[model samples]
Target chain A: MDKDTLLDCHRRISPHIHRTPVFSSRSLNRMAGADMVFKCENFQRGGSFKPRGAVNAILCLTEEQQEKGVVTHSSGNFAQALSLAAGRIGVQAYIVMPSNAPQVKKNAVMEYGGEIIECDPTLAARESEAARIVKETGATFIHPSNDMDVIVGQGTACLELLEEEQNLHYVVAPVGGGGLIAGTALAAYYFGKGCAVVGGEPIAVDDAYRSLKSGKIESNKTTDTIADGLKTQLGDKNFPILQKHVESIVRVTESEIIEAMRLIWERMKIVVEPSSAVALAAVLKEREKFENQKVGIILSGGNVDFRFKGRP
Target chain B: MDKDTLLDCHRRISPHIHRTPVFSSRSLNRMAGADMVFKCENFQRGGSFKPRGAVNAILCLTEEQQEKGVVTHSSGNFAQALSLAAGRIGVQAYIVMPSNAPQVKKNAVMEYGGEIIECDPTLAARESEAARIVKETGATFIHPSNDMDVIVGQGTACLELLEEEQNLHYVVAPVGGGGLIAGTALAAYYFGKGCAVVGGEPIAVDDAYRSLKSGKIESNKTTDTIADGLKTQLGDKNFPILQKHVESIVRVTESEIIEAMRLIWERMKIVVEPSSAVALAAVLKEREKFENQKVGIILSGGNVDFRFKGRP
Candidate 1:
């Protein structure tokens, strides 16, 4: 997608999404030895940046498609996002979630006026359930991260970040289904002066890292990382954008992810999911490259089930 | 204390403290049945609003006193605040923390360059140790929440809140040792058009609530509340201000405190200590009083030792 596409997508979704604030901590800067600006999508609607894409995707649909409603298969932040976005837009959302999905996740979707269709805890079951819903209700199947509209919508986060921080030397984002990093790369490539885009991936599920090295989209052998959101493989639609605009993909271990997540929560005083911490983990893991430079990191989401095991 | 005292105190500490941002969530507004604004002292330096008072107290000290350094007997946020504030202002801080205080807290104090002198956890023991240190080193003993300078400094948070939310109908704060609520009451009295101040106290240690009715400072029989920061009783210094300007005091149960804390973490996506949640809990408990009215709540701090029981 081009600059106009991103701008138009942002304009369409602006009214529906929160223009979340950017946060920075001197202690975090000292730890990383760099001037860092964090775009906190953790505070975004549905507790993640997923709504940026979900809203834009739903809004871009044809009148007939909008009438038919939207459907998606996710047990994560995207389900809540799509549900909330659709509810706000006066469109019905059918979320096909695994029966084993957390009750909190189900409640969140239902709270946002989404109808949940439960299936077995497998990709095929989820896909089949979503397909059945689409066929039965004439619903538009909205991919969480692999669609053009979603990518353009997701890019708007980086677009807004760049608008506020014009001189950022590098922009970092977690590479999950590749929508966010791809969109981020495009935003940096077009809107930034010379900002480089980088992706942070879990070592356990290093599909994006392997894909970059192999010059093709690669699949993970196992999805065993603490960063649950980064387990999905890259898609063909966003892979080309990453290859063209992304500077590199950095892989962090599970412990590194937990450490980074804890540091952000403790130091920044904000709740962030482990997936979001991967970007900061990547930065701290390879501190030399970003030392003394202005870097921007996208804290993807904060939909974590945190239990304070202190006095209470 | 008056408006100018708070204004001047804010000016003095402005260079050393963070003018932490105000946060709100639509979901929270819906739950409380009021348009609520959260003065996020949780994001304040030292993870609490203590620094505002700590820095102001230190800056108000005489040149000779500053040279002699500062001492405080506490094992809470104030210790960290005093340590960090002193380190930033190039003054030595002698923190007389209880030997049983969390190791993490001690580490934080040391990281901020404070010299810690451990003592027995009892009140008398802490007092004697602090007194001995003051006699030995001539260090000024800064009370955590009972001094006039600290009261004025703490009032700056409410002052800043009022500055942003000019038409708030009421401002709520945790009672604690009475510094924050008393200062908040004073700020609302002077600066707000007609804003009333409210105090949120833990039901288990409802000394502040009882003191208001009895017209005397009262001590708690048992400090069994989950809101560890609010266990202390109101002090003589701040009791008069609370009686004069505070409209009412609302007590919340431990369950309510935990429920409120979880709501903030789950819906608002911010980490807040249980004491911080008490303000919001009070607001929710007294929802009918604040129905459709604009309310401001000062989230006291975010230093809770949170553990994520979810995956990773």
Candidate 2:
């Protein structure tokens, strides 16, 4: 994407995304042997950073397209983000989600007035449902990650992150469909820090890592882990962007993801979803390489369903 | 406090305190039976509303007094708030805490550059330790909840809460030493809400409630409950303020406190320390009174010890 488009995208959606706090992690820093700066996207609007892109994409649609409404297939943060953003603009949002998606997430989408269509978890079923919704409702299919506008909108978060501190050695984000990490990579590379951007994924669903290694997009057979937000196969528009920008993709074990989640909540006192923890988990596994390096991490969301009774 | 000083306190400290998010909980609204407007002071700097008064008090200090430094006695949010606020002004802070105070809180005080002295938990011990620190160092002793500047400073939170949306029928806060509730009462009352500010306290440490009923401050023989923050006697300063401004104090059972904390984390998806949950528990108990009424609640802090997993 051109610099002008990126700049305009920032202007288009500045009000919707939260300028979430950047917290210092003394414990995580010591463990990773790096100076850690946490960009708390977990605190962002709609409990994640998706609103940044959703707002930009929805607002930029032509009047005719706006009249047609918007449609997307997401069961988690994007569903709520797009629905909430669309709700604010007096536009309807039709969300297609796998029937197995968590109730809490579906409830949030409904709360924001998003019309939900249930589908099977398989890619073919999800795509078919989304296409049917678009055809039946005459709503524009707003791709959660694949659209250039959405990706650039996601890029604005890094703009804000670098605006505070531009000299980071590494920037990291948990990769779902590669939109956040790809956009984050573009900002980190453009912000001029000799910066390297890393995509963090679970070993259970390491499509991004496999894709990077094989020099092509890849998919996982099934997903397992507490971070449901990162289970999606890489999107078409985001795959090329990911290959072009991201330095590497790291896979973290399930146990390591939980440990990282607990550490972020306990030590940093910031609320983050398990997916966000993957970035920190990746950093912790390679302490030697990151030692004392200035690293910026994006905590992707805070929408956990468990009731932590303050005890194990 | 005079009206001009109250107005000035709002202006002087507006930059320091974050006007945190107000989350709308439909279920909480249905359950609490009120249109709940949750004022998230748990997101406040110093992880609570303590900094409002501390910053105001520090700013009220004269040039000579500011240079001499500040001191307070507590094992809770007060110690950290005072240290951070005083440190910001390049003033040395000498905090005295009971020897049995949590090591984590003591470490936070030290991390903020406060000179910590350990004493017993009693007010007599606190006074002696603080007096010695002040006597030796010539620093100004800022009481946690008693001073006028501090009270007015704490009032700003309510002022903003009311100003944001004025249909508030009741304002509820967790009462420990009574700094926040007292300040809330003054602000809510002064704002012409004709609203009564209620206090929510843990049943195990119901000194604040007993003290309010007896028309005097009371102390527990031995503090109980996992809510380490609220195990305290009402202050000489806070007691009179409570008597003048407070409507009534409600005691919450420990189980209710834990249940409310879980509900907040699970549904609202926010992390809160236990003391904050007392306000929620109180609202839950008196759900009928709040139904359909605009209710305001303060989430007091997020500074929780690892031992408690940051909740009760």
Candidate 3:
């Protein structure tokens, strides 16, 4: 939407979300040969940046609308984020998940006070179930990454980062459904002194990268990436914002994402999911452009399952 | 060692080590049922609190001794810490490692500019090689946990913590060779308003707990615990310090340590070695003693290798 909307969203959600710390490592700096400031949303409420948008979206609704509660169809960080955020604001949350969703993910959602509505293991089933709940309960449907309120809310992380370090030359974030990068791009455009926004996408699910070249929405033929969070395709609501203000997107290999994730876990001593690593991997892959520049990286989430080998 | 020595050590090592952040989580606070503040030395230089002691010991050396450098017998965090500390002070470091030591550990030492001397897997061989190196090069020998200067240096972490939150009711640390817990006990006794010091020990290798009961330095019959950093026997230098000032040692099972470590990784979103988890495990095991109290827990280190199941 507008800068005012994003700033207002930040103000609304500030009390509910963490102004997560920015971390740096000397060895990591030496390895990338760049000055990197990481905005650790891994430490954010619900272990991800999703709560920023969820809280803002819920808070934006009128008391009457809020009284009706909210509904979302997802089995990822947003599910947990929405549940936690809604719980924090005293609003009921209905989370529709596929039957095949991992029990751990469902457990996390339940822990956050979300009412789980299990459907058949299919996208159509999830959406239809969520629609039925919304219809029955008069609950507002909040799309994970495609709502204007959510995008504005997500932008607050970048706003906080730029406020801390105004001289950053670039802000980098991993592109999944494009919400984070889009919000990051807008935050940089309005608040940053001269910062550019870059998106890192896994090559296996490079919808955002392809969309940038095609000048339209793109879809993935096969979602096979270690960064499970980035497997979702970009949606219409955030794509226009991404197209107008975002810089070029960089694609990284699965091996590179793993290497970057390991480096972060080893060097920075912070646990970040593989999706978060994609942004750092992009910077390492294209170090020449960012050499000696102060770059801010948005570590999107840290909700990883140690049981799974990858992409849980 | 006294309070003045610890204060001086803090000043000496202030420029070299990081004043790591204190982190708290709502879920963790609920789990422990206490106001737990984590002193994250896992984020310290050399990826652990070991550097605090290593640097102080190296700096305490005479100019002549510093010129010849320092030597230590270990294949753990101490080896890497000594090398990095010596390199920082422009001194040579000789590291005596068991032949069975992992290559990754050796590589870390080399990366920090330590000259590695391979020895038989036995502790006697490690000590003899270190002795030979000392004789040949006139390098001062520094025990990982037994030296006075190192003990005082290790106490600096508690100094910083108490300085930040003076109202802490107790300070807890994982008891290894009695260095961290001993130093922590002294810091709490002198600097803390009325804080007591508690030590966490593994049930498999409950040397510290047994030592506290027997009033003597006790050795582990079998060091089969996952908290490998704490398997070493308490030395004469630190044991007395631990005996006089420490409150009590709480023993936790290996499963408890893993559960605590997982909670920290999942909820706190920090990567800590299994040794570091022992303190939190102890806290969880004895929740009544710390109920509603302001407790400070020192996360000793974050130098874990993911390749092995444990104790890398």
Fnat for each model: 0.62, 0.29, 0.54
lDDT by residue for model 3 (B1-312), tens: 567888889989888899999999999999889999999999998889999999999999889889998999998999999999998889999999999999989999999999999999998999999999999999999999998888888888899999999999999999998888878888998999989999999999999899889988889999988888989989999998888888899999988888888888888989999999999999999989999999999999998776532211
Candidate 3 error regions (>4 Å)? A307-312, B308-312
Which is the better candidate, 2 or 3, if ranked by DockQ?
Answer: 3
How well does candidate 2 score on lDDT at residue A280?
A: 94
Candidate 2 on A1-312: residue-level lDDT in tens? Answer: 666777788877877666777777555677788998988887677888899989999989999899889999887889999999898888999999999988888988998899888999877898899998888889999888888778888988887888898898888899888889878877776774788998889999999899888878899888876778888778778888788888888889988888888778766656688899999999998777788899988888887665544532
Local distance difference test, per candidate?
0.92, 0.83, 0.91
lDDT of 3 by residue, A118-162 (tens): 999788888899989999999999999998888888899999999
lDDT of 1 by residue, B1-312 (tens): 556887888889999988889988988899888999999999999999999999999999999999999999889999999999999999999999999999889999999999999998899999999999999999999999999888888999999999999999999999899889988888899899899999999999999999999999899999898899999988889999888899999999998899899889887888899999999999999989999999999999999764545544
DockQ for all candidate structures vs. native: 0.57, 0.24, 0.50
Residue range A1-312, candidate 1, lDDT tens digits: 577998899899999999999999999999999999999999888889999999999999998899999999998989999999999999999999999999989999999999999999999999999999989999999999999889888998899999999999999999999999988998999999899998999999999999999998899989898888989988989999999999999999988898899889888889899999999999999999999999999999999885646544
Lowest lDDT block of 10, candidate 2 chain B: B303-312
Q: Any residue pairs clashing in model 2, and if so which?
A: A33-A291, A33-A292, B33-B291
